[model samples]
Target: MMSTPVANHEAIEKVRDLIQGIDNAMLTTMTSQGLVSRPMKTQEVEFDGDLWFLTKKDTNKYQEMLKHPAVNVAYVGKSYVSIRGEAELLQDPSKVKEFWNAAYEKLLEVPYDDPSLILIKIKAETAEYWETGNKTKMVKTLFERLTGKESEETDLNKTVDLD
Candidate 1:
């Protein structure tokens, strides 16, 4: 018997792990003029199957998302993850509470209970990730070889698709 490949599940988990290490992501969206990218803070909640963010409903980013739901979130740390998804503005209190934290109160001009506060829910449909070796490690290995010293080989580059 053969088993079906669980690519989606495995990929999601990998992306989630990367998110844990990096709390910042660049959210790219299309405007009537052109593409715009904004640095957004990731929610404190876990990245289960979706990515969460808080923004103001009246902001340019929110307006852009409303006009074009298609979006891409890029996160870089030990690896790089590019997630493609459709964004939806959420206003539910329960959901807001789920992702809300006291730290966010100072970040936003409006209160958490403010109706203008919108939650951006990204339903990721696909993702791509690239893992590269640390900068210091790579440089050190190159220097060792140049100095006639033996250096251990390592496989550093890896690509993964989550779709």
Candidate 2:
């Protein structure tokens, strides 16, 4: 239940550290059929209340963003993080070039100047993360669960307000 307020710098910095090296995030978007998730490569830029991803307008995710802007981004690496936010489609060419790399160029098979290429800017509202690196905490949690008693020390789970 520990939630970091928006004004705290530690909250945002911790979130950035957690998701720093994650290659891809599962972006969950709402659609008429319900929620759909897809693996999307996040931009290398540090998290500063916003997350960016490169996508093409021809994709279903882009269309879904048009219908519903709410989305969730999940990252699993050293820790598990869940980011809730609203999405905005952008055609900022300069930004595309900034994050673009040879790998992207090879995979997309098109230059960064392609008309369909677009950026998805996620205005993150909150980030919830769980650190699984502590084995002692995990065992204690399991014991507590078995005995139906809560521990004084809480799990290494926190919610950071990004907005």
Candidate 3:
């Protein structure tokens, strides 16, 4: 299996790019019964290793977090990123205004001040990422083409590990 560039800053940047470029992510939260997942709209703002979303405090997701704060955020595209983090329900009006978007008003049907409206803050603790045709793959492809040798597609899933 190929070793992921876990210590490489470039690799981290690539992972962040994938996460930020995506508009939707699967937020997996633990419920008293079992794991629950929901499609959530990612806020358009800087990540800084944290992901934020707007929601209602009365929603099942909020209730679930009150019981269990551990969460897994999944974003997949040409690559995949699985982020393990803790989620907290935030009620700060300033933060709400900072991440607020007019689109959310229409999407959630809740005003900024609606008592139910809340900010879900996910503070990532660890992450694992894998990509197809990233730098390493491109280099291999170039070398094989120059040598008139056919290259086999690499399996990245077998190469990834997280703390």
TM-score of each: 0.78, 0.87, 0.74
Give the alpha-carbon lDDT of every model: 0.80, 0.89, 0.76
Candidate 2 similarity to native, TM-score: 0.87
Off by over 4 Å in 3: 1-14, 134-163
In candidate 3, what residue range of length 10 has the lowest lDDT sum? Answer: 154-163
Candidate 2 error regions (>4 Å): 1-6, 139-153
lDDT of 2 at 37: 99
Per residue, candidate 3 scores C-alpha lDDT tens digits across 1-163 of 3335664344445557767778889999988789999999888876665789889876899999998999999887766778888998888888887777788789888777777788899877667776654768756876887798876854444222222
Residue-pair clashes, model 2 = 0
Q: For this target, which candidate reaches the highest lDDT against the unseen true structure?
A: 2
Best-to-worst order by lDDT is 2, 1, 3
- What is the descending TM-score order? 2, 1, 3
- Tens digits of lDDT, candidate 2, 43-133: 8898887999998899899999999999999999989899999999999999899999988888777898888899999998889988879
lDDT for residue 37 in candidate 1, whole number 0-100:
95
Better of 2 and 3 by TM-score: 2
What does each candidate score in C-alpha RMSD? Answer: 5.0, 2.8, 6.7
Answer with 1 or 3, whichever has the higher TM-score: 1
For candidate 3, what is the TM-score?
A: 0.74
